[model samples]
Target: MENIVLRRVIPSDNSCLFNAVGYVMEHDKQKASELRQVIAAAVASDLEKYSEAFLGKPNEEYCAWILDSEKWGGAIELSILADYYSREIGAYDIQTTRCDLYGQVTPMEGAPEEFDQTIFPVLQDRTIGTVIEGCALKLVEEAQRKRSYTDTANFTLRCGVCQTGLKGQKEAVEHARATGHVNFQEYS
Candidate 1:
């Protein structure tokens, strides 16, 4: 297996980031809309909080990751936990029809031709679930590090279907059910 490149997200990556999201949404409609709304709200409400928590933090500490293969495979956002990721969060969950109509189709519009240039690799290889696993691991690692007397990280993600502990966002969606664990559908 080749080495994977993981790093923090930047402000310049907005378009490409949405492209990746669009790519994932191709699988499901309702779920996709819910995720987009969640992420958009999080980004809009307190962007500075996300930037500091996900970008300013150290790798495997508090930041999210975009896993990319050295040769093929594009990047995916993982470990999307933030102070504002709540199920009761208020935001307009866009519909799939709106997403498609708005040109948020597969292969990611406004992305580069090359795999590296595109948001999530021009060529899709790994499943979205795999990307989620990487994200969960990163979150767990960060929570472990941030464990303090007053603050502690929580590993509360459960498989939406099986109810077992899910490794990533894709898995949670793929296995959409009452998986016992409370899942926060953010960033499809």
Candidate 2:
């Protein structure tokens, strides 16, 4: 028999990613605030690694931006959290039907030190890619190419900051640049 993987649903708040990770690691769903703080501290402590060039914004700006409770977190936050907890994270993107993996591997149960230090990351990365490539992800991706997925280019969006309605990613980006209001919600 195969092990059934069950998902523990998290809230739909902006901090859902943090809450989900917290729940999985420590059985706590309300750790978003704390997790945000952790990411801020981690990024601040290592400006060299999390520089403006890498983060697409000033390090201080990113730190401050991420601390906002309404700001949504992404790969950067998950990578920081994974490092902080010393655990590999695999985030499932329901929209894409994909799992984005993060963090440093700590070796298998009985692996040699040399292999663990040098080859594990590469191996795991390839294995995950191979698995996804061999699975139904191809079908989902094909459907997406066939126009089965939502046209994010023209989806309805509303600025959560000022109750301003907008259309699609282009308007959303413009709104954020103009008003510095990054929080948004999709509307039908």
Candidate 3:
């Protein structure tokens, strides 16, 4: 197995999504404001293309709001950023084990070829983290491997009635009390 580990970049405040994008792009956190400005400008420059579905407001108003430092970036902003940078953006929810992809703009026939860059979003609560597709798969695999070992190693009790596993004596007793299943044996 590869010893690849994902690096985390915590946001200074509510601009976590923007900061994560900046980190993935090899930019300093301080540059997040600038990145936001760039995205806003791109949206402003092509109001018709963005439309209400993407911006969720009048093009001008959305542009202004997005440029504000206090504003949080969401799917709309991420989609715009993806197009502006010609990269794919992925958001991962670790607890739910889900990942959503954004920014799949079709290339303009005559435009320059887009780079295969991936941007990740780290959720505010730190319960979720995102990375490129390849890295994300690695993370999922590692998590599953660790989970299998943890499940087997930590479970100390088994209910004889249902053959259900329990983590400890307390859980075993509780299960028996709640389910009226008195028979249990500790697994060796």
lDDT by residue (tens digit), candidate 2, 47-137: 9999999899999999998998877788999899888888777654445667574211223444432322211233645874354333334
Q: Candidate 3 lDDT (Cα, whole model)?
A: 0.62
Better structure of 1 and 2 per lDDT: 2
> Positional deviation of 16 in candidate 1, in angstroms?
16
Quote model 2's TM-score: 0.66
TM-scores of the candidates in the order shown: 0.18, 0.66, 0.52
Query: Where does candidate 2 clash, by residue pair?
Result: none
Model 1 superposed RMSD (Cα):
19.3
TM-score, model 3 to reference: 0.52
Sorting all predicted structures by lDDT, with the top scorer first, yields 2, 3, 1
Off by over 4 Å in 1: 1-29, 52-78, 81-188
lDDT (Cα, tens digit) per residue for candidate 1, span 9-70: 22223233433333333322223334434444544455565564554443432212222211
Q: Which candidate leads in lDDT?
A: 2
